[model samples]
Target: MPATLPLDLFLGALVTVGLLAYLTYALVRPERF
Candidate 1:
């Protein structure tokens, strides 16, 4: 259970960061999307 907790948190953070990056890129270049 302890090991799974850290893995879950890491995956959540990774996904959040990816979403933020994609949003920022889309905002910067709206023409491409």
Candidate 2:
């Protein structure tokens, strides 16, 4: 439905951002991980 489309997009964007941020952090501090 139209109403669920925006929610799906928002969730997808949030997950993508979180993954990118985590990757950046891991790259910055390789010793911890």
* Model 2 agreement with the true structure over 1-33: per-residue lDDT tens digits: 465568788999999999999999999999989
For candidate 2, report its TM-score.
Answer: 0.81
Model 2 is weakest, by summed lDDT over 10 consecutive residues, at: 1-10
| Most TM-score-accurate candidate | 2
Against the true structure, what is each candidate's TM-score? Answer: 0.80, 0.81
Off by over 4 Å in 1: 1-5
User: lDDT per residue, candidate 1, 1-33, as tens digits?
Assistant: 364567788999999999999999999999999
Candidate 1's TM-score: 0.80
